[model samples]
Target: MDSTKEKIFRCAIDLFNDKGVSHVTLRDIAEKVGISIGNLAYHFKNKDYIIAEAFGRMEEEKMNILSGVQQIPSFENINNQVEPLLNISKKYRFFFLDTVQILKSYPAIKHKHQAYVENSIRYVKAVLDYSVGSGNMSPEPEDDKGLYWRVATTAWMHLYFWPAEVAIRGKSDPDIGEVKKMMWGVIKPYLTEKGIHNFETIKKEMYASA
Candidate 1:
């Protein structure tokens, strides 16, 4: 990306995070980038174009984070996943916070976002499968093949909306620690004794490293 274009992209993200996406205009982004609207347009045709580019980068960023997951699941690996994932959400706060509006307003973005979300849910299910196969997590109960799918969907829901939930409550955005706790809470019931032990060990290491 050109340096100037990158500046405009970054400035737009920050403004969208500060003001809701619907509240921001191309002019706002241009001013924030210290460039004129015409120059900004030269880089991005319009707000929708900028949003499309932003989501494209977001997909790439998320893929990088998911690619770090190990073949064998462990609490430490889960920690590695959750922390950066939450950081991404924070960095692109408006995406989660204004998801409904964005989807409604941009048909192209909505289709892309839905596809990305399905891939993400599959990633979560894969982690669960690895954890179960490794004896860290219990098998899904009651012969329910859909158990993993439902759990993965629920986890994605929390991951997608937790930031928005916090913001709507007028609370300061949560740190990774808080978000991690909520994530673990979602999966904790399915953890085996070994899983619990691994979690505790990782918790100690995480704090020590911090």
Candidate 2:
């Protein structure tokens, strides 16, 4: 990306995070970037274009995090991914902060987000099943209700809305370490004795490294 375009995006995202996206104008981004609206237009055409690019970059970073888990899923491997996921959410705070309005206003972006969400849910379910097969997680009851689906969906809900939740509660933004602890709680109940042992061991190392 051109340096100017990069600056425009950085400024736009910052403004969007500070002010709601609907309230931010192209001029606001241009002024923040220290460039005239004309110069900003030369690179981005409009605020919509900048929004698309910002989401594209966010999607790329998130995909990289998902791809990092190449090995069969385990408690340790899943734990490794929590921090990166939280980092992505922090970097794109505006997206989660205004998720409903953005999805309503941008049909194309909404479609893309839906596709990404499907993949994410599938990934979580896959990890749960893999862990069960490997003896790290306990199996669901014999009735085999949608326990896994519910767990996966609930975890996704927490991750997607955590920033907004904090804001609504009038709380400060949490560090990744705090976010990781809460996220682990989402799946902690499913862990078997062996999994709990591994999780306890890994938690110490993860926090110590922090």
Best-performing candidate as measured by TM-score: 1
Q: Candidate 2's C-alpha lDDT?
A: 0.81
Tens-digit lDDT string for candidate 1 (1-210): 559988988899999999988999998998888889999999998989888988998889987777667453566876778767877888888889889999999999999998999998888889888989988889998878788788878887777777888888888866666666667778888989988888897677655654
| TM-score, structure 1 vs. true | 0.90
Which RMSD does model 2 reach against the true structure? 2.3
Tell me which residue pairs clash in candidate 2: none
- Candidates' RMSD to native: 2.3, 2.3
Question: For model 2, what is the alpha-carbon lDDT of residue 16?
Answer: 90
Indicate the residue-level lDDT of 66 in model 2. Answer: 67
Worst 10 residues of 2 by lDDT: 66-75
Q: For residues 1-210, could you state the per-residue lDDT of candidate 2 as single tens digits?
A: 559878888889889988989999988888888889999999998877878888888888876766665354766776778777877888889998898899898888999998888887777777777778878789988797889888887776776777888788887775666666766788888889988887897789668867
- Give one clash count per candidate, in the order shown: 0, 0
